[model samples]
Target chain A: MASPHANPSPRASRSNRATTVHLRLRKEIVSGHYPQGSALAEPVLAEHFHTSRAPVREALIALEREGLVSFEKTGRTRVRTIEAKDIREIMEARAALESMAAGLANRNWTAADTALIARNIDAQANVQSLAELSRLDIDLHHHVMLRSGNTRLLQLWEPLRWQYEAYLVEIFKRQAKEDYRPETDTIPSHRKLLKALSSGTPAEATQVMMEHVLFNMTWAN
Target chain B: MASPHANPSPRASRSNRATTVHLRLRKEIVSGHYPQGSALAEPVLAEHFHTSRAPVREALIALEREGLVSFEKTGRTRVRTIEAKDIREIMEARAALESMAAGLANRNWTAADTALIARNIDAQANVQSLAELSRLDIDLHHHVMLRSGNTRLLQLWEPLRWQYEAYLVEIFKRQAKEDYRPETDTIPSHRKLLKALSSGTPAEATQVMMEHVLFNMTWAN
Candidate 1:
């Protein structure tokens, strides 16, 4: 069957067994279910997925290509450690991408887009947990990216999203032990961005988005 | 085995047989060896590849996800026509990506990086056929993106590159029937971008790259 999936899913593993395995392993590695530098045994993964080693091996190789997993000289595949350098590069790449996306969104945004983000902001206004805030942030940004009407940008954003989100959640947890002050972080910046995307120029939208993504709040808001 | 091959190859098909089939079909479609809107019959492709229907089906599905091929409601799969809208969106997407790469390259470029792109530019200066020029263009841009020191950026660039290159060749063929004057198009712009990439600020790099990519000459250069 021709792939009907058009969202930000990874391009890896179009074959049935392999895609299922790839998605699961990708999620585990990105979400910290498989801790950094932990070896991924093919046999173990095969057993866990209730499949043979072939698909597991395929998925591991795919993950390695995405920078999430690394193959050591010892021939063991391990989850790559997400160091500070990794975070900087990944974050910068995301900034460039979303900034372009913001410009497109500014050009193509509709009332539906405005309404959607406005509602998301309204939800953010009531959010308490850092984790909840981060999810909302991803949703808002993803909505903008989608409404931008650029499938290519979204495809590029897919792999990076997992790494960005993992780091985002980690940073949020480390920086904010308690509920966020919604007034200071997400509310104003997102509102300003929403307004720019809805009615302002492309330059305005890109500038706001660049700042929001680059020197993003330390708390991941 | 883990994927050590990293230079802009597709994320699809880590499994051996499917990968081989996928690569060949992708090259054919992107090169227009198989004309756009040509039906990709599974049995015929399977026979031609000396493989069963399985790998060909997998490859077709993967191609569908990449937007090079579309599956109709009637269940026939064909190479999607590279329409004007597709070209514009694809080209703009490439501009945004390469512009970001240019900025990163400016900040982190090394001697080897400069040497590589310089050689590519020199080659472009002496290119003859439009086909040769298009390949050179892809080569030069790929070098710049690679030198940007961001693997994620390059990974995002991989899938888009093929589509960009495909339409680029078609556009070039239609626009210029004779040999290009290097001085008028690629030579000056590439030289300017390379110099900026080697020594200028990130903003300068991005600006020059964006112009070179956007209002790109009528030629594919």
Candidate 2:
């Protein structure tokens, strides 16, 4: 081994700032505060977020990797304006992932796992805020995927979840301002999905998840 | 936007160092030069590589994310000793992703694409060095996945590809030392895979890929 010549870098503290900046930037971009296709220069973002250029730079890279930001040809970075084709592609990947998750989750689900989902439904029913309602919807799907115990599957789905959420949140905001009720169909549809997972075999649960992801509910994309 | 208060970080040049460091360290770890579970102190690695701690740190983080390195409970970083369970899980994920890729590659492969695999087969037939042979094997799968035209699928497979390659390369090195010839099954098997993709339906190609990934060959775990 070589003699040590350098001090250890501050990975933990720096990583925390990068993560905080990443999540906050993701929210800002998803909420249309940054606006799609607008320039996201590192120094500008650093100034806006009250952070150093390093954390902002790290956040931009993470966002770009997640497909929420684009590195443009002329050396500029911008919020990605996701197209319908990209949306369709992401949805396809998400469908395969969630379908796989459902089969694995249903294989040996514990009582607590079932109760967790049932409790999520109860929360959905009592929720008044559309934002919270939409969050609960995302939370339930996340719960099922988490219950799958397939870490790789969850890891693969994670970036897509963030990218997809970026689009979904926009829709939620629009629907909220119109004072529209949360879609009545969501609760029943999720209830059906829960029933399929609980009583049906893995294959049946897989099929239901595929259908639920592909057709049961439509997103604006 | 507020006036830029800081010059943009030297992202391009610095990222190149990070990448250079990352690939070199991955090779060292995969080659067992830095044996499994050995402490990978940043200062030591930086000194050995003749670079500052920043690039070494960046490389370490990337390797950790790829599952080739582990961040220990006691705050030391080490090369991960991948367990059988982790191997099984990764193989399962690879099987599904490659199966999907095979189907998609078959759906719309071009003449160039067909020629590419054919050329790769020729190269595979002529290989003498196991390391070179192993590289070719990885290359062929990457080509097929690239032809799938599903960016997200490839993005998801990319990390697993690196990790799986790490294990496969160790086996290759061992076989080379023992004077064991490259498996006679591999060339023919790939020929079959290529043929199926060329002449069969996407579903058939997909089925062949699944079986090919799950069985057909064994590796030392």
Q: What DockQ, between 0 and 1, does each candidate earn?
A: 0.22, 0.21
lDDT of 1 by residue, A1-221 (tens): 23433333434324467768888888877677876778888899999997777668767766765677877655578887776777777777778778888998898988988998999999987886867877888999888778778787786777677777767555654576765687787789999999999999998998899888876733344
- Which residue pairs collide, candidate 1? none
- Candidate 2, lDDT over the whole model: 0.75
Q: How accurate is candidate 1 locally (lDDT)?
A: 0.77
Model 2 chain A weakest lDDT span, ten residues long: A1-10
TM-score of chain B of each: 0.86, 0.84
